[model samples]
Target: MMYISRRERFSAAHKLWNYEFSDEKNIEIYDKCANANFHGHNYELIVTLRGEIDKSTGYVFDLKKLSEILNQRVINKLDHKNLNLDVDFLKDLIPTAENIAFAIWNEIEAELKTANCQLHKIKLIETENNFVEYYGQMQS
Candidate 1:
C-alpha cells in the first residue's frame, strides 16, 4: 500500500485542569498548564493515509481532496478557537496533544473510509518539542 500525508496548522487555547481534582493537585500535575487563564499553541497536524494507488490517477489519494477534508473536518473546528470551550468533539476530553490526535482521528476516519482511504496516523505538534501520534488504537 502507498501512503500519503497532509499537514495543516491551527492556533488554539487550552488549560489542563481537571474539575474533579483540587486546584493544588491540578497545579502539581500540570504546572503552568493548569493556569486558569489558559495558554495558546500554534499546532501542526499531519494526517497520513494508506491505500492502493488508483491506476487511472496514479495516486493513493488526491492531495487536494485530502487537504480539503483536513480543513473542513479538523482545522475549521480548531483554528483560533478555545479547545476547552469552543470545540464540540473535544468538550469532554482534556485538551492534551495525545487526546487531540485521537479526537482528530475520530473526526475524519469515516470520511476517509468513504473515499477508499485508510487513516494511518495522526501526528499533533503542540510546540517545538511536544507532539503526539495516534494510530487509532484503543486505550486499555
Candidate 2:
C-alpha cells in the first residue's frame, strides 16, 4: 500500500481544567496546562492515508481533494477557534494533544472513506516539545 500525507496548521486556545475537579487538583494534574486564562498553540497537523494508486489518475488520492477535505472538516473548525468554547466537535472533550488527534480523525474519517482512502494516522504537534499521534482504534 502507498501512503500519502498532508500537513495543515491551526491556532487554537484551551485550558486543561476539569470542572469536576477543584482548582488545586486541576493544577496538580495538568500543571501549566491548567492555567485559568487558557493557553494557545500553533498546531501542526499531519494526516496520512493509505491506498493503492488509481490507475487512471496515477494517484493514491488527489492531494488537492485531500487538502480540501482537511480544510472543510478540520482546519476550518479549529483555526482561530477556542477548543474549550468555540468548537462543536470538541465540546465536553479535553483539548489535550492526544484527544485532539483522535477528534480530528473522527472529523475526517468518513470523508476519507468515501474517497476510498484508509486513514492511516493523525499526528498533532502542539508545541516543539509536545505532540500526539493517533491511529484509529480497531474494532473487535
How many clashes in each structure? Answer: 0, 0
- lDDT for each residue of candidate 2 in 2-109, tens digit (9 for 90 to 100): 999999999999999889999889999999999889999999999999988888899888889999999998999999998999999999898989888988899999
TM-score for all models, in order of appearance: 0.95, 0.96
Q: Model 2's lDDT to the true fold?
A: 0.91
**Local distance difference test, per candidate?**
0.91, 0.91
- Residue range 1-140, candidate 1, lDDT tens digits: 78889889999999998889999999999999988999999999999999888878888888899899999999999999999999999989999998889999999998888355688999999999999998897659
Please give the lDDT score at residue 79 for candidate 2: 97
As for model 1, its CA RMSD to the true structure in angstroms is: 1.9
lDDT of 1: 0.91
